[model samples]
Structures are given as structure tokens and as C-alpha cells.
Target: MTFGGLPTRWEPTGESRGVALVAPGRAYSPAAPLLEFSRRALLQHGFTVQQLWWDSTTRGEDEEPEQWVRRHVEAAHAEEEADHVLVVGKSLGTRAASYAAERGLDAIWLTPLLVDPVLAEGIAANAGRQLLVGGLVDELWDSAIARELSDNGCDVLEIADADHSMGTDDAVRTAEIHLEVARAVEAFLSQI
Candidate 1:
């Protein structure tokens, strides 16, 4: 159902240790298996999940996803009583890095567009705990920036031969990578 103009899916675990705000990519769905796996992992770790799914086709060129994320996150955080807030963003969703940083919220950026000068600034300016996960094969993935972030204490996960979606042509390896991704996210959440 929609929450405050945002197409939101909120899964509340009876007793929560924290809240996880999930943001999908421009073309990605919140129901994607990787995100679903993250939800399950979060739930298992005593966290509630709030997923925001957006349709890029309907958005105008002037539309800024960072604004959507900032608005919704502020509203959601106000409504939630959870002590810890964690933001999980994928691809386009990573544009909210600056906003998330401004709010002092920890974030996990999946396949972040680090090559974009505008987006890279967000990551650079962010002081919050940031976890960056990307594949070496993805053209937009900037290892240099990721290395810098890693050196500065951001958690980094680099999957070999994986594409933008962290997927490989080999089904078996893809499945293994998916599990690895889920486990890494889980590990990151535990620290926050």
C-alpha cells in the first residue's frame, strides 16, 4: 500500500531491534529476489523492513530520487521509534547518500553509481557508516573510489566477474554470489 505518496511495503517484525529502509533502483523492483533475501535476513536478525519502490518511467527528467528518499526517510523516521535506522539502497537509490548522511543514517549502497560526479560527491561528503557493494565487471563501478571509501572505514564488498546486478552467466556461481551478498548485508546490519 501507499504511504504518504510513496509506494511503500512495510514488514514489521513483532519485536524490532532496528528499522531497515529499503530503496530500489530505477528499473529494479522491491520484490526482486536479492532484496527479498535481504528482508528475510533482516527479519531473522530482529529488524523491520520498509521498502520503497519507484517507477523511473513515470518520473520526469527533473525528478530527483534523492529528494524522494530524503522526504520519505524523514517522514518514516519520525514515525518509527526504533533506536537504529539503516538504509539499504540499490543503484539509483544510492543518490540519497548525501541526504542519508545529512540525517546521520547508516546506509548500504548496492551497485552504487560511483562514476557519476554528482553522485560521487554524496559518498565523499557522507560521514555516516556506509557499506558499498559492487561488482568488478560493472562499467560504472569505480574501484578507486570504493578503495578510498574502504581505506576510510566504509565496508566494501567486491564480487569478481559479477555485473551491475551482481549476477554471473553461470547459474551456480550466481546463486552463490547471491548468498554471499545476503550474508554480507546481514553482517553489516548486525554492526549498526
Candidate 2:
């Protein structure tokens, strides 16, 4: 099934023991820069990446982000039952990940949009089994929500001294942040 938008490229390696679905942020495509970074990072951790683009009706014609994700996830499951699906999302994509969690899918949230109570409930529901990464400085997630997530069982990892992007404008700093994200995901995926 096409799931509306562009289908994500699945790079398979013999070492890959599981499948990961990369959900894009907002109206963005699965191949967007941030998603690509996460995809490569997952590959490093030995997961075959399935980049799923959310066709956002809110952002464009006939592109409802929520519907797109649900469809993609169902399609993914039909194609191959993932040992665990690591749902990585940006701003809007974060919301989509939460929905996936409610359906009992394992996830890895990057800079999740915690303002939404639904998202929190999803994270709380999947706590230690899934890793939740957020910036120390992202206003999108408030302290109370953070506490709730931790209280509910989410493994909250704060990116210290970083903003929403988790890195300064310097190339070296960005790479460092990416590497850090990669390591965290790899460690978490390894444990699962």
C-alpha cells in the first residue's frame, strides 16, 4: 500500500533484526533532513529503516497527518511485523508517534511535542520500553509534562545545554549531537 505520500526507502542489512518506521515532521516528507539523520542513526544501530511519509492534509491538499500515519503503520505491519517499531518524529510527527504508541507500537520520540495530553498518555503508557529524547530547552515540552512522562514510565533523556534542535549552528556541534542521538538510539534498540 502507498499510504498517500511518498513511500520511505527501506535499506536492509543482514545485521538488521528489526524494522523501524520514520515518521516525518509536519507536512514534511520522510526523506527530509531530520528524518534522514534519524534513519541513518537507526541503521548504525542495526535496524532496517522504513521511512514513512505522512501526507498532511492540514499542511496541503488531502494531507491529513494523522490519517496518513495510521494508514502507513497498518501497511507496515502488513508488509512485515516489526520486532519493535521505533517511531521517530519531529514536531507534528511526534504527535503521530504518540498515536502509534496507543496502538501498542514501540517508539523513539525525538524532541517530542509534549503539550498534547494524548502524546503524554502514549509515552506514559510505553515508558522504559521506549526511549523519549527531548531538548533541555524545548518549550514545546513543559516541566509538568516531563514529570508526568517520567512518572508514567517514559525513559526521558534530556539533551543538556541544547535547544530544540539539540545543537548549535556549528557543523561540529551538529555532528556531535547527531552522534549522541545515534548512540542513545543504538543503546536503546540493542536493549529491546
Candidate 3:
């Protein structure tokens, strides 16, 4: 799929009933290793997957990341005829996905960015379920963020001893995070 003069990173998968759309973190490319893990995790649980790379470099200076995400989502859903779209985003990408969900797309946001009001408004607007993967022990996140999300009706899933990335650079923790996401996806898909 394509958006705003930039080429989107989309992969066709064999699974039916669900499709995953992942947005990479800031300064991260579409080819980042995390995408592979996300793809495999979803595929393992029977979901077709697609990735959309949304970074500062890909959007216009005044453009909202959520708007960009929505465009990509519309194109992907139309082209692929996907039954449901699960949005897996990291950092700023999370912000974008949450906002897109608010705009009335059926999605499950993974590790969504909860800091920005613009993004938060969209998330609140969505009225859809969310999955939080942040570490409970990390200093970066406190109870307030979690409370705010829950207050806004997001279903928070805290990962103990994980960081903002939800995994150590080590292989074992990375695998664990991937597994957690897979389980969350399964649960979310089952509900819908």
C-alpha cells in the first residue's frame, strides 16, 4: 500500500479473520527487527499481517501522525479486505495508532503512547479496548499514566520488570515480550 507519496511496508499473509498493522517507533525504519517478531507473533496465532512505517521523516511537518495512519489503514483495509485490523505501535507510532482507532476503526493498540493529548483524545474517542505492555518497575512510567488510560476506559496490561520497549536487548526477554503480545492478541481477537 502507499500513502502521501511515501511507500508503505505491507506484507500479504495467509491467515484469515484478522490482520495486524504495526507502526514503528521514532527513528526506526520499517525493516526493524521488531516487525519480524510482531509478524511472527500474530501469524503464530492465525492473523494476517501488514506493517505501516510512520516516523517523523515520513509525514509532513504539519501533518498529524494519526491522519497518516488513518489513510494507510483505509487503503490497506480496502485493498486487503481484512476483517479486523490490530494496530501494534511503539512510542510515537503508538500515538498515531491510538488516534486512528479513535477515528472509528476496529483495532487493538499494543503498547500505545499515552502522553500526548492529541493521541489521548483519539484513544478516548475510540471506545475500543487497548493493551498496555509497559514495565511496571520502570521509572519512566508511573501510576498516573496507567490510571489515565484506565480512566479513559483502556484495558491496561502491565508487564513486570520490562522497560518502555517491554523487553531487554537480550534474546530471552525479547522472546518473552513477543509471547506476551501474542497472548494479548489472542485474547483480543477472541473477544471480537
Best by TM-score: 1
Which consecutive 10 residues in model 3 have the weakest lDDT in total? Answer: 6-15
- Root mean square deviation (Cα) for candidate 1: 2.9
**lDDT tens readout by residue for model 2, 1-192:** 344554455655656667777766665666655567677777877778877654465355585655665666667656876665566766666766546666676777777878777677767765336667777677776667876676776666777655666666678877787678767776776677
Best first by lDDT, ranked: 1, 2, 3
* Candidate 3 vs. true structure, TM-score: 0.69
For candidate 2, the TM-score is: 0.75
Candidate 1 local lDDT, 1-192, one digit each (tens): 674575455555577878888877877777776788887877888878888766666655776766765665567667778788878888887877877777778888889998987777777777788889999999989999889889887899998788998899999998988888898988987787
In candidate 3, position 111 carries an lDDT of 50
In terms of lDDT, the best-performing candidate is 1
Cα displacement (angstroms), candidate 2, residue 135, comes to 1.3
Backbone clash total for model 2 is 5
lDDT of 3 by residue, 2-119 (tens): 6566555434455466676667666655455455555666666667667665546767878777676666656656666665667776665666554456545545554555556666
Best of the two (1, 3) by lDDT: 1
Which stretches in model 3 have alpha-carbon errors above 4 Å? 1-15, 29-34, 136-142, 151-153, 169-178
Provide TM-scores for the models.
Answer: 0.87, 0.75, 0.69
Clashing pairs in 2: 56-63, 57-63, 57-64, 127-153, 127-154
Clashing pairs in 1: none
Ranking by TM-score: 1, 2, 3
When summed lDDT is taken over every stretch of 10 residues in candidate 1, the lowest stretch is 3-12
